[model samples]
Target: MRESEYAESRADFVHQLRIAIKEANETQYWLELLHQADYINKKVLNQLIKTVLKS
Candidate 1:
């Protein structure tokens, strides 16, 4: 292959790598947020149950 073709391929590879990394990071962020939200929801539900039982 030619030097120019190699350079273009390298550039494309880097671009795709960056996009993949961005997507992975975003996915991790969402997963973490979901876990935290679920935890909070459980805690709230437990408190609600306790309050109802006391009433």
Candidate 2:
């Protein structure tokens, strides 16, 4: 995420932001999958999901 801060151009900053968003979405997906598979409990899932969304 901090990569965007060091972007050399506005275009690069936007590109970095896009990459961050994509990664965040992927993290959320995995969290959901883990929750469904019972690898994580509701509390942990909620905490992680909240953190990801907040990012």
Winning model by lDDT: 2
List residue ranges in candidate 1 displaced over 4 A.
1-8, 39-55
lDDT of each: 0.55, 0.96
Residues 1-55 of candidate 1: C-alpha lDDT, one tens digit per residue: 1223344577876776666566656655555565577854655655654553343
After superposition, the stretches of candidate 2 with alpha carbons farther than 4 Å from their true spots are none
TM-score of each: 0.54, 0.92
**Whole-model lDDT, candidate 2?**
0.96
lDDT of 1: 0.55
Question: Which candidate should be chosen as best, given TM-score against the real structure?
Answer: 2
Worst 10 residues of 1 by lDDT: 1-10
TM-score of 1: 0.54
At residue 42, candidate 2 shows an lDDT of 88
7-39, model 2: which lDDT tens digit per residue? 999999999999999999999999999999999
